[model samples]
Target: MLLRKPAASELSAEPILSAAENYSGEMHAIDTGVRVDAVEFARGRVALGRLLAKRGIGYGDRVVMAVANGPLFAAALCAVLARGASPLILHAKTPAAEMRRYAERYAARMVFGDGSSETEYRETGLEPYLVEAADWARLLCANVKIVDESAGNVSLVLPGVPLHPTSGTTGQPKVALRPGRPAIAEAAHYIETTGIQASDTILVAAPQSHAYCYGMGTMVPLLCGASIITMRGFEAGLVQSALRDTNVTVVPAVPAMLGSLMFGTRGDLFARVNTVFSAGAPLNEKTAKAFANKFGIAVRPLYGTTETGGIAISLPGSQAVAGICVGPAMKDVEVDVRDDGQGLAPGLGMTYVRSESMMTGYLDENGLDQSFVVDGWFKTGDIANQDTEGRIYLHGRQSEVINVAGMKVIPSEVENVLLRISGVIEAKVYSREHRTGSQSVQAAVVAHGVDDADVRAHCEKNLVYYKRPSMISFVEALPRNATGKIDMAALSNL
Candidate 1:
């Protein structure tokens, strides 16, 4: 399933904006029904690009887009890319402090924001392209022609730079950057891997700032000529309404959002959603099974990183299985398991990747370097075993692996078994050093009507004695980060 690289000229000339031209003339986007066309989209982007250029934005300059999901956000991003400047998109809901740090770290020259964000930027003495009130109409109606000559070079000067954040519950999130070649390759791989087509209508509920939303939610749909339904934010009711209203066929969401749609909302939220892809964190088998049983549709668990792009490994709707075996490597990508920094036999040790879509490097105060790889393969911190069939089963991060009496215990393995208990909602297991100079496993669980005895009994049936938790702590709910991943650092403090 190797994807031959298409020439840059062919890709650039391809009608990415044709959906707005040839498709439905009156389509509902956000709160308005607007007719779209390639010409109009082109015109809008040119107008915005010209404005950005006049404001001193040039090729290779970083323009931070801190806007919400909508037509403007899409147009602005495409405009920036088309004009030869790199757009550094940040989640609109990201904390002001974090956003400021990203802008400073990247040395972004200008920022595009809505009214609320404009206020925040103003206090920081930064100029913001505030797209609210009269400015919105002015910017969109500028009528500047986008000159094709300014498309600039496809190759980036910095090549790979951290464009998105990883789900870090330990401390400040780690950012990974994929270069142009790998980024485009990964985007294409995701579309091919999922069998996404021009006819598929994708419902994007994740924030446009996140990689899942930005790549799958925006880039793939455009590249594949699929219609995208963008939501301002995730509300269980809004998701249900959009599912029915838009005839959305495919949905990519985090587990937290899926859990809410499956149990929090009643009356056929999944009725129109044929394929549901869940990622960003591990999905427990119980939740996956329950969703499938209730919705009569498979909940496909996907695995990847911002550095890697969308769904590197995923089960298709037809081959979906319960729990987290994130299928196999996508087309044009390779996955290997390693032990002691050497490639291991199939189905054992740490997972390593060598793919067209892998990130180039990480950029920080110290500048960028190829941080996570040895030779050519990028060592994914995740520990896993791949079956002969090539299905990958994740066993948690290597940093989190516990050594109990010299035998390694992966916390996710224990937590998976614990989550299957009747009343257990969420569980986290980790290793702690004991006074006796041995490492012992501790479990933190969020349950309803399930006590330590019940959880212990459940684990006893599924796990070996050496893998069982030495102690269990109960919490009303597990703390999660902004991306809805469990906050392990916060949990450690608890």
Candidate 2:
């Protein structure tokens, strides 16, 4: 395992929820079809923490949350942190079996959100708590801590920051633990780079499960005392509506979401947006140009990995794209290219980084193919070249980390799922680029009896929307080359 918990704090730091309450009452969070002020959001965390405390959850306990992006989700995360219980925050659409596996592995105290089976958890001493939106909101209003602001002085003691999930070649999920020490600094960095003002209303339109969105959208905005507008997920029409309704100034979105919103009929929707920042995947050249032409602004790229969070981000008024450039590294991030022993000026090689919030490595697994860290630098498997001005341009990845929309899909993970099918003999999954300049998951399977639909259905059970194969082809055999190995070239042709 590559994960190591940060040194435990002896003296109490300030409680995250209490710090959040320092935001002015005028600051609000909009999501789940309702609006609540910043104090109320903080109060929600306080009250939820009280409830967890009452239920015997204490410091260092693990809470599994499967939540969508919204104010409640953000507040719940804060509640876990305030109570000193680290969260294993899962995507709302995570499969039930995977949730169970995580719960069992960690011996989770509670599971919150959808797709968690009550029966499976009953045996593991795990408690399942389905989030009641109305209840959390009501609890927000009912928090006694908010009534007496003196309670803000007592800080919450965390064992560490919350955890992030990463997958290996075998497709078994592992937790990547980040250091809590750099979290607040990274949040402040976003505020400094973006020039977020007290009155700015940042939009949390992307998935909160992403470290970027959670840090930038939830954490930074709260620290800056800025308001936020969020939706569950990005739909072109829904996002357009939120933009109009909220007059959203700053948007944290992925390239695919931007492509969908821009290419559609909703023109002039981005007029109010001060900036559109994209991460999760590289913004395609075609998408960037179209956005700049239509909106009179470039879609800036925010590049990083699940392991190393926020390596580089394009600040406001910065040019969004210049030959696949992802601007310069953000504050407190050191970037290096490990090309033999060459200098760090700029050449194609593996990207190495030492960042404020980078994870130690994967948890619960003994060893993996490549070491996540060397010396002190975290090895990012991206092929890149940096210009003299410090602008970095990505060529591609050294591994098969497929970027479908903005979500990272490990090819072997999908291939492993395919092989699980009863009639499947061999399976290979790869991405195919569409003319729209986006990628789709495609699979070629050597199987009998089961058709393409069956294979797809099986995938639907295990994988999320983006991870499922968009197209499936069943054949008598998978073509092999001179070495008697599966030929990805011939597979792509099929």
Candidate 3:
């Protein structure tokens, strides 16, 4: 576990429902054909609160939620918060056994999942709260007036907030525990920074379970009265179709999805889109330029981690200086780079950030560990530098840096060079360990009619000798995890 919690005295808890209550937007689902406005969503939230109360879920009790993305998921999130239950959201397809394990590991009071997962959860000896789209719709839009038992009560204390899981690219995944005040503060900052409006319709193709989509796609927009259109998963055809059919002005996508959109038709494909935000992984210059050249739109690189909520984002129409630059620190957020004491430049080193919205700590099996944060800053484990213009340029994960004969090689730098070569569609660079205890740079490439020689030749022209890939393997596709990030652990086998 790389992160630990701060002291309990440093944490402050507030009700997250205050933000949800301010939402006057709408949620539209592509697959389920369910449209819920703010009023409907609130009604459903209150009703769901009753259901959770019946299940004996309340303040400080942890609940595991594996519901799929849609209006219902958003409602369920709010309802869980309303009942003052800390909620941990997992991937919708997570097996019932794994869900139960996480529940036990986290000491959750109950598990909430979609209708499809009900039987499996029951078979696992857990009576899960099954959320059906039809049932949710009826709860929200039904004509029957929902009686509120504690609508006027002011004594309730909400200490529960949403929890997130790390992507585990560096190691095993750990759960992030956050306070309600910081979580709501982060959502407000994101909504204000992005300028999300009531009239704008945002398209969400990324996994809603992830922090990026959960905040930017669902919470940010809804909290500010902006509508959202969600797709269960990202497919080029489906996403493009939704963009063409709907009036989606903002599209928050990962780099993988943006790269996939490069091969398809783009004749007015993004006619109505004025903003596009990319995160989760580094946005290679190839895809950035290609998307801009083809669609006449600039790709804003948003930078943050699940544990940090949101730290920085390139505003609309910001140009990438040198490489891709995730713009300056967001409002009320402080960002800086620390020197590694290895002769790095003045403003270039490990990225450290601190904000009210950052997570309180990491949840381990034993209990809360409060050691990750030093003083007030959290080490982000990323090699980054702030340009003179105050834009953030990421090198790569510090753990992903390759050491060859005591020299350093950033994989993202090498991968970017590979992507510049003709016919190269995807590229991932890593360090390969030899039996003699030395590491050599290796690359896995997905390209069209490109071989090792072509890759080497390009590297020779662009990268230093040690920085160039010593070995290259051409494959049809790169293996990716559920969150659209390349599975670094699985790359060593290649």
Candidate 4:
């Protein structure tokens, strides 16, 4: 009942599909050198949907797509959903074997992959349909792809939703099922809150597979009749060039990507860009301030999880509260904190959120995992505090909290102290377990001129005995996943 049926003359025209047909601007895939206007995008999706339906991807069928951020991803998503099939997205760089493993594990009916991964899919008996940006020009314009015009124009019936895999910062990734109407509602909320206009152009450097980028980077822009240019992956040089060449008005990125772009730049590059959204990971004070100082625009913090499409975002021109605020709850979203007695600040506690856009439940081996929800609220497993004006200040995830003999050490608090030390570029604080079954605080730092002793001296002066790092290792860089969150598993091995 949420999505009204489109007219018989229209092709799969729902909210996002309808917007694609009505809007006129182009969506570009920089790596593939492909660009198409809204009408072309809509037609391409319809054609692709028919192809998928013919391939036996219909109601209740789940298809796994290992496509990157580009026109192919956007068009393919609409196509799969329009066919009443669930689509599971994986990172483009995900290996062929891993892609096949996920497909088999998730019981996917088929797979859709790029040219590079097609052979692996076929070898694994996945029978993947190869989707290429190079083929898009022909696919979008060629009427031959759609055998029956009337069948293509028939109403798009939805019987399945999209599936998203959690970032798995703490452990193995979990599959999340998000209902169709709620996901669309979340996209509409984001468009209204961000004030996205029909003329605005968004540069989506983040991978489209992630829920945050899928909404802000793709769906919100399309639904608002705005243009979007997508990159296969995050690259500082290509992003800078895109900014210089394209009329980009908005940029949606993670904290690490924003931090990387702060160097070797003049204020003029982002002169036309009005909004820069930082999510996926914590937005440090240094990165936010340096970006604002260089470009005259502050990086707005957007807080969300794979389980929830988007929760809160800092409003335009809002000041950061101690350089750690995610402004306020999104429209129709409820956010609150609960005391877990884990030794946080006075008001800080475990963060909980409930929203219309929240996933139905986590997909597990047995079936769905609704145990994560209490009443109607989803426990976010984040340590945070909310002010009277309703802004949320995040410390870090509860799982990331390092407990030193009953004393809790928040990683962000220690990382912030390290950043204050001169020459320290990046820092990650984690717990190291000893042979005696006790956890000790360990810090890994990336710095230009600072050494272990200097870091030790600074921490001794600023932090309590238990909160200070027992071991410090200097590294050239921190290992981060595709979404820019520190790969804790990789860090532990280091």
Q: Which candidate is the best by lDDT?
A: 4
Candidate 1 residue-wise lDDT at 82: 55
Candidate 4 at 474: error in angstroms?
A: 0.8
Ranking by TM-score: 4, 3, 1, 2
lDDT tens digits by residue: candidate 2, 1-494: 22333346411224344446676523333444667776566667677778767766678666777767666776777777777777777876665556656655655556665434656445444444443334434221111111222221112223535777765223445676554545555676677776877777788777777677877776777677777777666667777777777667888877657666765635677788887888766565556766788888777888877677778876555554432578878877888866854222245666888866666455552422125666668877676777787777775455555777777676655776787787776676788978888888888887878897888789889988988998898887767532123566788798
lDDT of 2: 0.65
Candidates 1 and 3 compared: the better one by lDDT is 3
Which residue pairs clash within candidate 2? 2-361
**Model 2: how far residue 137 lies from native, Å:** 4.1
Candidate-wise lDDT, in order: 0.64, 0.65, 0.75, 0.75
Off by over 4 Å in 4: 1-24, 122-134, 137-158, 167-170, 319-323
User: Please, what are the lDDT tens digits per residue for candidate 1 over residues 1-494?
Assistant: 11223344322312333322333221135443443444455566667767767767676565556666656666776666655665666776654445556655565555565424545655655444533222232331111122222222212243112256664323346555544555556668887787877778787777767777677776676667677776667778777777767778888888878777875565476677668888888887777777777788877877886766653556655334446588887887788876754232244687778776766555444444454555657777777887788878777787787878877787887887887687888788877777898888899888899887887788788988989998899998778765677877787776
Worst 10 residues of 1 by lDDT: 140-149
Return the TM-score for candidate 3, rounded to 2 decimals.
0.89
Candidate 2: where is the Cα deviation over 4 Å?
Answer: 1-5, 10-19, 25-31, 114-160, 168-172, 315-323, 341-346, 365-371, 401-494
The TM-score that candidate 2 achieves is: 0.70
Clashes of 2: 1
RMSD of each: 6.4, 12.3, 6.1, 6.4
